[model samples]
Target: MTKFGKIIRRLQGDESGAALVEVAITIPLVLLLSAGVFEFSNVLNTRLLLEAGVEDAARYMARCSGDWDTCKGFAQNLAANGAVSSGSARVAGWLPGTVEITKISKDATDTATGVQLYLSTKATVDVVDVSTDYTYQDLGFMSYLGFSNFTLSVSHQERVIGW
Candidate 1:
């Protein structure tokens, strides 16, 4: 055999670097999987927190008797900080301005039958929808993976009871 071919065969038969090669391949994959798990858990936790805040705000607004502007403002505060007034945000990087409060009024009567559309027999039903999108901040994992930051959105809807 040629000198280079003989050297190649000898190196391939050697097992000295086998464990090193395996470890070199395994460690990075393990780290990547671990990082993915951590990031997914973090995102899930943030989404749950945001959902709770949105539900609270939507429920509060549904039962609120205040005017439109003030109620929306308080709802924003509640969603972001879990309080009507100023407080710390529930999630990091979450701001009150990120919350969007929308009010939707559905016709109470069915157009075809001219009867109440809702089971509650109301002429009009109001719904409060609270929504927000949060930008997740990873520990440079996504950037290392050549990906941009991802956003998570949460929303809650409640029917106005006027109670």
Candidate 2:
């Protein structure tokens, strides 16, 4: 064989760069998957925190009495910050104004789905619903997975025992 033919055959038989090429191709995929998992966990954690705040507020309103406006204001503060007074929100970007405190009553013969939520438990009293809508702020990792900033909605309902 000629000199060029020998050189071509030798280069073709060499497998030294094979592992490097494989690693280079797979690194980006691994990184993307890891980032996606981290983003999902962060979003889930925020949702849990928001739900806890709403639950606390609903429980508080279930036993509270007095002025309707005052109770609602206090519930809003509690739902937003986990406190009945003004304080830092449990989740960033959450505000007291975003919290909604609603009272739902059931008639003796009402068959509405909302009122029948506790039918299995035989609860016949009124209910207090504490809810909030929050926009989640991500660390820019979710953009790679085709997800943008999304809204999280959290709510809790408690049976009211106060007249």
Candidate 3:
């Protein structure tokens, strides 16, 4: 047999490195998938926690009949506490620094007798808007994919139910 033919036969029979090559190609893909799953889960959890905090603050403000400054302080405190309770250690500073409270006077309407009556003629209804901005920092693996930080803004509004 010619030397070239022998070399071709040897190359055709070589299967020893196939598994290694396959593993080398698939390992990186699997790792990337795992990292993506982890990062996504983290982001989802953070969002849920933020939602819970905002909801808590809104509910508190809605039920509070206190002065504007007192109500704002209460809402801020409640939101900070809620964040801590939600298992996010980084939310403490973020809440106070980013929390925004706005109060608006709105006309109340009553429709108990098949007719709309303006209740604000007697007393005004106050609505409180609470909003906060948060930054989510990628733990580690996601940083490798050029994801470092993301901004999340959450807000909730509720009317004061005081009579």
Candidate 4:
């Protein structure tokens, strides 16, 4: 056989570097998937924390009838506590101009002595609306993939009870 034919045969039979080539191609894809999973988990955890905080504040407001200022203070405290518990170090703080509280009232009739009478009175309901924005600092890998810092906004509302 000619030298060229022998060289071709040897090259075709050589499988020594096949595993290395496959690993080189798949390693980066595995790493990218792992990073994505990690980032998604972080986002999910932060969202859950925010939801818990909001729910707690709402329940507090519902149980205790208070003025707008008092409810606002409670919401702020809950938001800060949530940030600490979420484990995201990059969260700067809750965004301003997002917290809101509104009061509502409605009039209704009452029945007494087998007669319906207009009470001419209104019942007041206090609604607490809380919204918080949190910033997440992406990992270097994510940044390289064109992802930047993003904000997650969470909001909740509750009506005052036992008022």
Candidate 5:
């Protein structure tokens, strides 16, 4: 036999659960990677949902003029049921059962921020402030890793009369 054949035979003779070793080394790595993907997907989905919620809330607030309860109830309903993955809890936690409208400028001023809208919505939530865990729990497999909380917050303004 050739030298290569002899080396191959020698290696084969030293069989010592190489497959198990490879799997042992690789299983955790794969799980960790997959867990990260799952976590990111969860965050991305929730972020999308939140963005949608923001749009809906802003739109609804722009269209309607209520004391406070009316707008918050509308926001909760829109954020919760609108997305493919419901965000009722997140919205509620973010804005709380009762949303306090900090400001409602009819003629909004233009700034370097972004938009100048006739309607601006701002609500402070004093629920638990544990969005990270909340969304982490919402995740599928990442929950097994005990990642069940995070921080999520944003301010949005849209034009009222324009669009």
Candidate 6:
């Protein structure tokens, strides 16, 4: 037989299960890649939550620095408040069921005429609470793959408006 003929015969006589074997080996790798995507998305979600919570707390504190009760309430509202109520609302679902807002200080900056009170707030997020109550549709894949919740802390300082 010619060289071309021999090559054609070799190709036709290839093992029947070659494709099946390749697929089997690749399946696990595909699944792992998908899992990694899910995990990375979860991490991004966590970061966004941390950012939003910090912004809310800071804005609230900056707005009302003179009144202690109002400021704490505002800070608490920021810490957990409706921050979880708006936007993606996905990560918000993971927002700690109960968040604590601690005041870093209560002092005014600048002169008496145009005083800007500086206040700091911190929020402690509970991972367990997130798992139990988070509503991220049917996104249980990552959580199943050991993407459990963890405490996230956020801090910010804001200048209170008015004297």
Which candidate wins on TM-score? 2
Every model's TM-score? 0.78, 0.81, 0.75, 0.69, 0.54, 0.53
lDDT comparison, 2 vs 5, better candidate? 2
Comparing 3 and 4 by lDDT, which wins?
Answer: 3
Model 1, residue pairs in steric clash:
108-123
Give the higher-lDDT candidate: 3 or 5: 3
Which is better, 3 or 6, measured by lDDT?
Answer: 3
Q: Write the per-residue lDDT of candidate 2 for residues 70-122, one digit (tens) a residue.
A: 98889888888878997777998888889888998754345665544454345
> 1-163, model 5: which lDDT tens digit per residue?
9999999989987968989999999999998898888778767876766666656655655555554455556654554455323444544344433222233334343455656533445422111111111222355565566655665554455443321
Off by over 4 Å in 1: 1-20, 109-117
Q: Write candidate 6's Cα lDDT for 67-153 as tens digits.
A: 665555545555554442333333445443444444433334434665554333322211111112123333566667666655555
Candidate 2 vs 6: which has more TM-score: 2
Model 2, runs deviating above 4 Å: 1-5, 108-124
Worst 10 residues of 4 by lDDT: 82-91
Local error of candidate 1 at 63, Å? 1.1
Write down the lDDT that model 5 would get.
0.52
For all candidates in order, the CA lDDT equals 0.87, 0.84, 0.73, 0.61, 0.52, 0.53
For candidate 1, write residues 1-163 as lDDT tens digits.
9999999998997889899999999999999999988877877888899999999999989989989888889988988898999888899889988999998888777888887666666567888889999888877777788888988888888888863
List of clashing residue pairs for candidate 4 = none
Which one wins by lDDT: 1 or 6? 1
Residue 63 of model 2: what lDDT? 86
What does each candidate score in C-alpha RMSD? 3.1, 3.7, 4.7, 6.9, 8.7, 9.8
Candidate 4 per-residue lDDT over residues 83-144, each given as its tens digit: 31333322345432343434444323332353323243344334556666677666676688
Q: Runs in model 5 with CA error above 4 Å?
A: 1-13, 65-72, 83-102, 106-148
